[model samples]
Target: MRIPRGLLAFGLLATLSATAFSSEPQWVEVRSPNFSVVTDAGEKRGRDVALHFEQMRSVFGTLMTKANVNLSVPLQIVAFRNTKEMRQFAPLWKGKPTEVAGLFQGGQDRSFIMLDMSIDNPWSVVFHEYAHQLMNGNLEVRTDPWFEEGFAEYFASIEVDNKEARIGKIPDVTYQVLQQSGMMRVADLFRVQQYSKTYNESGDHRNTFYAESSLVVHYLYDNLLLPKLAVYFDLYLNQKKAVEQATQQAFGMSPEQFDKVLRNYLSSGRFKYYPIPTPPAVVPAQFTVTAMPLADAKAVLADIHLHSPDYQEKALAELQEVLLMQPGNAAALRGMGYLYLQRQDLDHAAEYFRQASEHDSKDPRVHYYNALLLNRGSDIAGTDRMAAMKKECEAAIALDPNLADAYALLGFAQVSSREPEKGLEAMKKAVELSPRNEGYQFNLANSYMMNRNMDEAAKIFRELARSNNPEIAARANSELAQAEGYQLAAEGAPEAGSQLAGPSDAQSARASNQGVSVEENGPAPAPVPSSAPVHFVKGKVLAVDCSASPKAVLSILAAGRTRKMYVENSARVIVIGADRFSCDWKNVGVAVNYRDRSDGGGDVVSVELQ
Candidate 1:
């Protein structure tokens, strides 16, 4: 049934009026939207999400579409940075409450797609949700367990993205009604009480909800249901036409006729597949980027012709090859440095950035990014490395005087070097180029405060305080108050005298140790305090002792905990530090792949829960 006219009208008007699905999300002047986005990360995640989706699409297309079901539908996905993000979207769910990730509303033009990036197969959940979205976009008819869920489960049965991959057929829910009660054909079970169901109404079957629906969908796919699906889509979604009319229009038959075929396929209980005799080839464990040959080296360099989307890894890899072939190939060395920096592979990134600087003394991107990678965050490589990186950034900037990124990189370097003045100048220059960049604006304010330029700092802080971003704005307000107090003291009546009375701005700044804004540091949490720990963990898995096998780790299955700390990853090591461990461990890298140790979920991969 349609939503109450009043409610439908109200919901549509409300959602449509709220910011019209941002045209250029990246360019939007994000004032501190909600949570602070991590900086230098340009809508770029450390791992490839879009690639994963494409790989999924490619694999699914190869397997499912070739056999039958043609479920191709264009979809716009909203990938969240993490679960912490919810203020950005309104829930668009129908039926019972959905979990962290799913399609909230399929009926509307812009539906909610929340994928918890923290999960390993976030794409898998996205794949399941897309089935709903696709069905809504294509068929336009509302469906129940036998259709909606069955299709989702069917689509989820595609190959996983691993060298040695396996796919198993399983239902989303256990104890399905068809297997247990043997009542109601999948055809009728799929149809909703056309007049009563809507997004707000909640009703769903526990068993047969997911699994049976999936099996039914698989039947349709195997039995050539794509054309029928297309027909449904054309009739209903395309024209908002009625079901019987759409069925007649697409299949040249009434809806009742299609229902008959659906029954025959489902009841047969036989599935179709060209079974894999052996698992897919698993590549060796050794990690190495493939290299281009000597002849291909020149072609590779030619490939990196500035500003090309198809810039191949070969172009960069070839540079390495060329350097190896002739150690002093300045062009190749410089190219290698450029490519290394491009990938942000800092040590190699630095080597190439250095070569470019040495050969040309002016390439901006090389020096700028090198400085950034070398210094940013924990300084994994150390401060001396950062200084060298920043120095290169400065040289790159000096050579051109208009390198915006170089300025940005230089600003970070200056901050790390305790030279807020130089940092302030660079940050300002960067802002001039990209005025809306949050990181630049943020650093500029910090630089101002460091130089005791509180008035200017407060101005920027006040501006950012009203942004859509919560983290930066919160920090801005707190900083604004500090700046205001500094202003009051600057007017006289304080121990710190004004620099204006003594000498030039630079001289006075140097004398007073000006621009030294810093947060106070306190004691760190000690490991010994684990004694007073409020939460004690159970069923701890010990890392393998003296074992060469990387996967020889013990599985720690504690009761009442979904969060599993990985012994292979850094989690358990830090939590249970080296000092407290009684168990002898092997050469690290041991991870319990699955927590439950069950095979029911059909080739689902699980890492240690935590």
Candidate 2:
């Protein structure tokens, strides 16, 4: 259902000059409850765009039986007056701009939907991408590429009128394409992945893949077999069953039999669609429209370029131009700060963020960016610095309560400051806001570990160890092993290196670790004693001296100071969040727990790659 960015960029350049306006078009911003539409297509079209999105969002929630359908990341819709203007923003192929009726660009902090208003109906392509975003926000588990794309295609044909919305209507072009380029086997279709050549390449085979995927979903919906999809996925993914076996078990038929049935259904030309009354929440009359300054509008375009890898320089130029016209423009300042942040120029990023904050104290993004910059800096070991980061995160959350990233960062800061209970609560809130984010889930697990809740931590890590993302899976597996070790230690196992001789002995050990004296008569019930008093530091590894083989020395930059940490045995040292420890590691962010050495340095206990 998702069109490749390359496809959106592949068309003749001759059509670029087809439409022209007699006078410069005015840009306006249309605001609804859940969406923002910035357009040169007049207020009517802008209001219609906002209303359509609100209606679609409501319909998605109703169909899924979800109470909230809001996306975690902010989205901005840009409606160009004509194809000519839209072409200018399209992705470039071989140094030339490619034509497109609509394009969707996704990012971590924000997303964009650009439409060519000259076209009568430019919603299909954008709608497909929109469906993917909605699923990402609502679904807890990642589904197969086939199901994901097929379901998006199934919902992409949604047509809305004043009273109701019609869904599941297949376009005639799909049938024509599939007929011309014969379908693949059902098993092969099910096995296709996002990285498969057939999914990435542009050809008749790819066209047929999309068309057949949609037809299969349509068949499932019409036959009332949609509920069985969970069974199929559980068999294929969790049980590790083959595509053919899972399909046979879930659909009550072999792949070959299902193929025949699907072919017949396609040939019979009989399909059903769903009609549901529009929710009353979507009211176009209540939407607000206001003229936006040209400089500010250009800043949004610059932000779009900033998120694109190929257009960073153009983004800088546009931001500079905006600043020249309006020196104190808050949006432009924030964009500049983000641009510098992406480039890893921390000083400039900090300065721009500081200026932006002063100019617009109420902007949540400025506060969020400040927090992010602090998190990425090397001086976070200072309590005051960490408190500043937490304050920024708190400000951002107060401004935008649904900002999941702010809660995530706040949780990290709290954990680093040794406030495990507060960290756990903040991390839970983050996961509640963005349930599908594996990274947030990983952080939540880490928070549980800090709170000494090993069972909960291990459960999350076990689930994440099976993730499709290789990095997250590797990290989860490593953390899962550590969590198990912690659980054993908590149970007073000798193998975990924390077992005490007796309860009195454990109290004495805990008092010794805490630098307190034990009572002469009898000590009160004491918590389990850890290995030793370990100091935590988060910073960059400046250099590694491995001249001593197993006993390597590390130069780390923490709290704006260089500290020397000695590793007893590099091979035996505990490493988390990475597959293996490397003596050559340098300039990478890392968190270390170490004990103070007699030489005024540190003896490394564990290292966590950040």
Best by TM-score: 2
RMSD of 1: 28.3
Per-residue lDDT of model 1, residues 545-591, tens digit only: 32422112343434533333322212112221132122454233222
lDDT tens string, model 2, 1-610?
A: 9877776555322244333322547789999998999998999999888877887887787656654587777789999899998877789999888878999999988889999989988888998999998888777778888888888888787887667788777779878987888878899999998789889899887888889999998899888898899899999988999988999999999999999999998898888877877667767888889998878888888988898877889999999999998999989999999998876677899999989998999988889899987766545455666688899999999988878899988987776666778988999988887888998899898778667787998899888999988877976776676566555545554433433223355433432332222233332222222333456677899999988655689899988999998886564355655766788898998877676778888887668777
Score candidate 2 by TM-score against the native. 0.83
How many collisions per candidate? 21, 0
Q: Please provide TM-scores, in order, for all candidate models, with all chains considered together.
A: 0.30, 0.83
Residue 484 CA error for candidate 1 (Å)?
3.9
**Between which residue pairs do clashes occur in model 2?**
none
Stretches > 4 Å off in candidate 1: 1-344, 355-359, 376-390, 468-471, 485-610
Task: Note each model's CA RMSD in angstroms.
Answer: 28.3, 10.0
Which candidate ranks first by lDDT, i.e. highest? 2
